[model samples]
Target: MEASSNFLKRSGFLTLLMIFVLCCSKEVNIPEPVQAYEPHTSKIREILFIGNSFTSFNLGISYHLNLYLANDSLSYKPLIQEAAFSGYSLAVHLTNEQTLAKLNERSWDVIILQENTDIAVNDTMATLESIKAFQELVGNKGTLIYLLMSWPYKDQPEMLIPIIKTFEEGSQAIGATIIPVGEVWTAINQDGNPNIDLYNADGMHPSLQGTFLAASMCYSHIYNQNPSENPYLAGLENTTALYLKQKAN
Candidate 1:
């Protein structure tokens, strides 16, 4: 009888021990969501920017883009043009004569497309239709098109979801690459490292810091180089620039 009792207790202890080991193993091997990336060595030169105030605001993305490339030691530089309109949506740009005229006027190596912030979030169909229209307009051209995903409003953080989705859908539909600037902004805010203000007082336009971050990511994506390696600060402190560069990746 004593032997039987001892055997039962030993079995119970072994079972508990096995459960503990299994739990620990699972904890140690927790799985995380996989991220898909496309790393390329393509060099972009002779670019054009088209969109609303996001592309045309405060020296605009093109201005800092040149600064970033010019500062890089790798010797890649491009003539950048800004053909952005204030408060314009992709839908509006689709019909705008100036945008079309610019496309027809020059042989561009790449065209950076940015949609209005609210339109991208609230009206995805418009975004998609506009992208389709642009693709059709630029048909058969060797110029590469890149979607510059705009960020959400400062107060409306959830606005990011649809904006990102629209950009992703548009890029996939047109077979273009996305600069993912909006996604990077979301990440920067979530990571909270240095916690820099990416917006101007209006909470819509990008401040200098915001433009620097966007420019850094654009430079990194277009040149296929690590943003952290670039020495341009856009007059920002080294620490701030380093943090933005790391977040761009």
Candidate 2:
């Protein structure tokens, strides 16, 4: 009887030991999500920015783009290449040496041009002249895209609505693409989501969420991604990729 009891205890201990060993052997740990990336060259040859405080946006939009480039795990990081700044219009920046330096530095891959939200008002000619003058300096190889920055005027979308055609005209004339963030915001605003705050304290500049939306849109277009479906723009990417591919052929 004692031998039988000893055998049972020994078996039980072995079973427990096997369980412990199995537990220690390995755990099916899911890998962490890989850091975001794009299939672009390691060095960002050049990029230039011209726009309003909206384009500058507490500089959040620009910084977020840089962050996306810097954090990418690929061997090559997307560098700034070059940058220029102006408020409200391109007129000031185009005249400045900084704009020339940025343009002259390299055959830029992209040039970001943005106009003030109130282009329907005064000094729009100044904005247009800047774009025209800068285009002369902007080398032929780079793709220019007009950033259609959205206003945070959640209450008065009407005041902000007229700028759409202005952006489209800029895009058509300059052979540039439009970011169309205003369209995105207009659609979102129409949904009447009470939970989302689209504007900053002044009710003009986008808040963080608005910035995220803009950044996501920029990210989507630049990387050939979509913003809505894939959660952080997974679905949008494929659609753009396919579209670009089809267009190329």
Best by TM-score: 1
Mind sharing the TM-score for model 2? Answer: 0.66
lDDT (C-alpha) at residue 119 in model 2: 57
Q: Which runs of model 2 end up more than 4 angstroms from their true locations?
A: 1-45, 81-86, 120-126, 141-143, 227-249
TM-score of each: 0.79, 0.66
Per-residue lDDT tens digits for candidate 2, residues 1-249, read 999999999999999999999998987888999875443443443455556566666455666656544544446645443243434456656666766676676676677776666653334565556666667776466555555554536667775545666665566666667777776677766767565555788777777666666666665676564433232322234544333222212
Scored against the true structure, residue 184 in model 2 reaches a CA lDDT of: 65
Q: Would you give me the overall lDDT of model 2?
A: 0.59
lDDT of each: 0.83, 0.59
* lDDT, model 1, position 188: 80
Which pairs of residues clash in candidate 1, taking residues 3 or more apart in a chain or in different chains? none
Residue 73 alpha-carbon offset, candidate 1, angstroms:
5.6
Model 1: lDDT to the true structure:
0.83
